[model samples]
Target chain A: MSGLRITTAAEGTTHRVVLTGELDHETAPELERTLARLPQAAGHRLVIDLSGLALCDSSGLTTFIVARERALAAGTGFELTAPPPPVSRMLRVTGLDRVLLARHPQDA
Target chain B: MSVAGHQVEEPEDREASFSALLEDSMEDLYDNAPCGYLSTLLDGEIAKVNATLLTWLGYRREDLVGRRSFADLLSVGGKLYHETHYAPMLRMHGEARELALDLVTADGHRLPVLVTATVKKNQDGDPLLVRITVFDARERRAYERELLRARREAERERERLQRLTSTLQRTLLPAELPEVLGLEIAAHYHAASSDQVGGDFYDVFPLDADRWGFFLGDVCGKGPQAAVLTSLTRYTLRAAAVHDTDPVAVLSTLNSVLRQRHDPGAPRFCTVVFGLLQPDGDDFAVSLASGGHPPPLVIRADGEVDVLTTPGGQLVGALPDAHFVATSARLTPGDVLVLYTDGLTEARRADGLMLGEDEERLPALAAGFAGTGARAVVDSLAEVLTAWADEPSDDTAILALGPRPPEAR
Candidate 1:
């Protein structure tokens, strides 16, 4: 079986999606569908929790960029939370850390 | 005679014993074979399962037979795939072979297995049941994962190298061309491919208060080795220009440096055009030195395009003592001077002719925008380069300089 799973939850005005397993070219479409289904109303906060994510590739990075654009167009707040060391390193190396807002779960 | 008669009398009893032994062995083999076996009804309901299959899945024969479907034993993703893809394929083709999937055990642990299924047909040729054989794939799955990890690591390593190459390539050129008062200057660098760093480089910097040093060059090859030579050449040219405003002297110093640094066995050489520019009244006095490099094109204020001829020049660092020639040109207020690497002339067109090989091609190209300023000329050339049907196979670098109009200045 492909090693990827996603779960969503709601808290007040914020919608949280927790991702697990490897996120690569093979499974990026599944994540894209999940992001597309998210509520895009103004004042909505969407927080993607990545603590359980094991891996990501260029496709995953592109998906995050698209999600950020969607949230901006709808006037919603978007952020990534609790990315593992490898994911954070990838973001830093690609210079995406400055563009994508990331915070710890406790901080969020 | 009595013993022989007794042996003949027991033959019928012995034949019956042998037939019973063969039947017992066949049943045992079916139940205890190495691979698991199962027969499912058309709707995937478990009709018959061998003891081996039941043991592998940690389930009793009663738990599966007539109760569970084959899809029910799969993980969530496996079940989805089976319903969406494999099931439809099986229905159409009447068989599915070597499908890799995971089976969920009674304890919720997944057992990686490879399955091959064939549809059984009755006498009327209608589907009766599906027979599937399952093989344990734990070792194969582990090996595949290792291979995938190695591939991912290699990709990441290549990405890192590209980043380093791009950053290093940037340092080899000036961050921003120095602002020269009364002179409009523009430059462009076109890389053939991003996988390897190209050795084409250009720089426009101030040598002193009145004079400026500018150059465009292409090394023999590309990547780390050529990049090292490019960096060294850029520094050497700038230093040499400071000591002497003579373009020929600057290139001669560079030629000597290249010859001394690299070994004779693996000689490194470059084609370069070094220039020194100084404001002379209403115009700029330009002295360009060639090291087997293409000559610069000058578009006069009156719309006359001319290519300066610098003869008897040899490639830099090619020999112990290489000669260089300095040519002079004057850039009037509306006139522009353009220097380019060989990549431009060598760029191939669809018809197999080079952009600058013919004598009339470059002059005609410049004539089209004869009165344009430095920036406009550079921008136009860049647009032309990008409009080609195919990308240039080599790196190209261009530098254009013109005196600003009196009113604009």
Candidate 2:
């Protein structure tokens, strides 16, 4: 039982993951399993929307890193966008915004 | 006691009739009772056994009455227990109550049972025979087995956790800091949880004849994965410092190494403050660089505290071409420079608010220990981390370095 919830949807050539609620040590594994099951094929893009994410800790950040690595290795494009204020602040603090959020979804 | 008003027949006639009834049922009751009963001679040879006892053991009465002893009916372990404890206790106390044992049946299957034995003696106090009762205990034995299994499982899990924690501690931390001339260094690590391993680490090592390198950092997570990241960060910084002494260059080298040796399984990122120290004139010159780490504090001799901030520094190993900035300061005699992990700044207050990285709380706390050496500053701050709250959410690491005062010299 974890506080985190994940939903996946496909629109056009993009596979989007929507995360809501807190992402901590206890709940990060749920996201990891969901990311692992994605078909990271070429000619597609993976985007995570974090507008409803209330909290994210160090373990959550690690999951994001692993997801990015996996999608890129499969020759698929990856990006994260629409992060809430607190999560955005954390990304800026850890300097991960440059690596993970280099492009906005609207721009794509 | 007789009831006179409720009497229906003459007292003598009623007594005679009741005696006749008891005589008729005595043998039948002994043979068919729910419990098994046996009578054995002084040497444990079976003298007489009830029909119930014969049926329970799947044996015929003639086969056991003269041939086998009471101990022969028991399993091997039960036989040993009967000799060592049951026999001795019965001999001393004239009775042994509720001794658990297993009985062997005709097919050699074990029948779990409880036995109570008593010595029957004559008027002169010499023992004539021993009477024994056996009760089935299969249900109780099954319950005990389940309890034993659960207890063993918990013990094994605890042992594994302790082994992992100790292994991480032994490999990730330095055994001792190198002694440097004219400089005093002190460090303390406070683990928030006893069983879990934290990601914080710090070390001070000599680079060459005239230069020294030191660092304190915190990896992103806790446990074995964090331990691997910490090991890589520490060794890379140490090797990079030997090749180049500039603080910014050393951090950039670490960033590149972390990016190149990418572990997609677990995140490899950390915040660190790496510093290079060298003697200049009567004081030591320090150049410190940050990889998105908390800035260090400079406590002057007169109780004035200043934060040495390296602005726009990115977290190492997370990005390509991560930027780092180095700040310089001079550590005069009696001045202390403090570097710590986020655990201290993020410590929660009683109202559930963080004591954030601001100019007020930490600097004010350090002002009280102005002009004190590195040991005093580190020891007192460590006490605060222990006493301020019940338990901090994260582990804290503190490192303080300063030169000896003029008076001491």
Candidate 3:
């Protein structure tokens, strides 16, 4: 069981990261610890590539929501891309797509 | 001679010794029974096990005593799950009871068993090694499988019953809308839920070609009684339309039939909108009679959307002479008339916000149509509804009549 490994890279003003393996109850704290260390830049966009994510329950979602709020408070753009079907569906069911400004804006 | 006389006393001693031997055998049963009995250190390691159990698993006392953990005995999936999820829970709660696991036997057969584990502690309530008990669950697994099969059969039976009811419910509506000249017409019904019956019904049939009679109604309550009223209203309207093309007179007859058939104590009433459409050359003129139903929505070719209010109309069957209000509209080319039940407006979102269909409805519809035909209108209406409702509605229905474009032929 591999814990979530977040690999970050800098592309000009945008901060891109990829999350891999399970994001769940006990392991969410580890993700938050990694998120807190990030430097905040005004208008910095955070694009999370979730293509390698295996599973995520409610705790993991709450972590993302909290992360999104922190980024938005600094007036920065935060968006996720390539979420697996399970995570994407959870976002849709919870109406996170509308709040987070996910892809396919017109449909939302 | 004296020693021979003491033989009875000797026999009593022998009986006492036999009882002592039985106690020794019982102690041996708990320690080295046919099944495994092992206690481990604070971290799972072989502490003690029955000789028979050791032989069955092909593990030596020296091989497992200080090295092998209980998790080591588990299959790969089970071991991984235990380390990631189960072990932590056990540490926090002091127990991991009746967890089903598979172990590799000496002959390489997967031995299925139910394991119960508990953490032992010292006087200071400190942690200790986990003590585990395993019970064979193959028979229980077979029993559970049988129960699952029975549950599936019961569910299938229920689905069949609902389908039959749905088919019977569908048969109670008109087969097709009568093709009224000089007008493009389309209608739809969106069921709030599939499991229960819906009383909302709509139809458009000719009161003799030139005059077309269309009715949309919601019978009070649900189930077979509402179904009965729906069937009665349709037949009575069809029969009365032949004699009287007047929309108000047609409803008056429906009122009488419902009043006569219903007992005074019974609750019987329905909201209906009956329209008489007549082609005046190339234009269409509609005279609508309403009985406590939502007024039709007119989406003009000019792209203006408004809810037509048909006030002062009484619900049918509730009054001796239900006062039906009559309103007239001249439908221009590219214009569409939508007569629907209140079900559409009343659908609740996840946040308990009722989707104000009349107000916020057009934007979604306008988006659905890239400025074109009735087909887009119908498709958009369904898409927006499924989006808003999220799931099948608690009680929602819609009926739209759109005019098609002339050029495509």
Leading candidate by TM-score = 1
Show the colliding residue pairs in model 1: none
lDDT of 1 by residue, B105-173 (tens): 999999999999999999998999999999999999999999999999999999998898889889998
Q: Write the per-residue lDDT of candidate 2 for residues A1-108, one digit (tens) a residue.
A: 339889999898799999999898888998999989988788889999998887777788889988888888898888888987657766765667767885757747
DockQ of each: 0.01, 0.29, 0.01
RMSD of 2: 12.5
Q: Per-residue CA lDDT of candidate 3, range A1-108, in tens? A: 558888999898788878899887567788777776676678788878888887664456656766776777677788878887756644443335444535575664
Model 1: residue B385 alpha-carbon error in angstroms:
1.6
Give the winner by lDDT: 2 or 3.
2
True contacts kept of each: 0.00, 0.51, 0.00
Q: Give a tens-digit lDDT track for model 3, residues B1-409.
A: 2575664457778899887777567657855664556677766677766565566567777766777877777788778877876688788898877777776665666666777778888889987677777776777877888999999999998898689668866887666766655556666676554655678888888777477888888876566777788888888888887888777888888889888965543436677888888776555788888776766766777777655655666667765656776788877667677776655554556764445424455443554353344555666666666677687444444555554455532
lDDT of 1 by residue, A38-92 (tens): 8888999989888998777545765776687678779988888888876765554
Alpha carbon lDDT of residue B70, candidate 3?
73
| Candidate 1 ranges beyond 4 A from true positions | A1-108, B1-29
Kindly report which residue stretches of model 2 are placed more than 4 angstroms away from their true locations once superposed.
Answer: A7-18, A36-54, A71-89, A101-108, B1-135, B138-164, B193-197, B302-304, B347-352, B357-360
Scored by CA lDDT, what does every candidate get? 0.82, 0.86, 0.69
